[model samples]
Target: MEIYSSLGIQAGISIFSHIFFIGITFYALQAFRLDQLFKKGRTIQIQLIYILLSIAIGSSVSNFILDISNWSKQLPYIFT
Candidate 1:
């Protein structure tokens, strides 16, 4: 009962974190000149790259934050 509720909460937090970070990542990525790096007329490919990069970077950041949060919560176990 309680465990299931906790799991649901955790899942919700994970989803929110991923989405929030992905949006932030996408916004930050706007500063990059990635379009210049690719060949001209690859608009679709460039768009895909942007989406993939956003997910990659965002998910990585989200995981790192979650790991830190979990670790902090476990710190009490380090002692009696």
Candidate 2:
């Protein structure tokens, strides 16, 4: 029962973090003159790859932190 609860909490936190990271990324990209760079085919491809990689990294980091937090909460003594 406790394990299930911990898993649920960790999932929720990871989801929230992913959404937040995506939102920030979207806004940052929009604020920049990315469209101008995208006018060139090569530049556009590079930019797309960069954005995808950034999002992937962000999600991975968020999931890792959420898992660590969940583990710490489940075993507070070890984390402390």
TM-score of 1: 0.97
| Tens digits of lDDT, candidate 1, 1-80 | 99999999999999999999999999999999999999999999999999999999999999999999999999999996
* Candidate 2 to truth, TM: 0.56
The prediction achieving the highest TM-score against the true structure is 1
Question: In angstroms, how far off is 25's CA in candidate 2?
Answer: 1.3
Query: Model 1, which residues run further than 4 Å from truth?
Result: none
Q: What is the lDDT of residue 51 in candidate 1?
A: 97
Q: Against the true structure, candidate 1 has what lDDT?
A: 0.98
**Clash number by candidate, in order:** 0, 0
Clashes of 2: 0
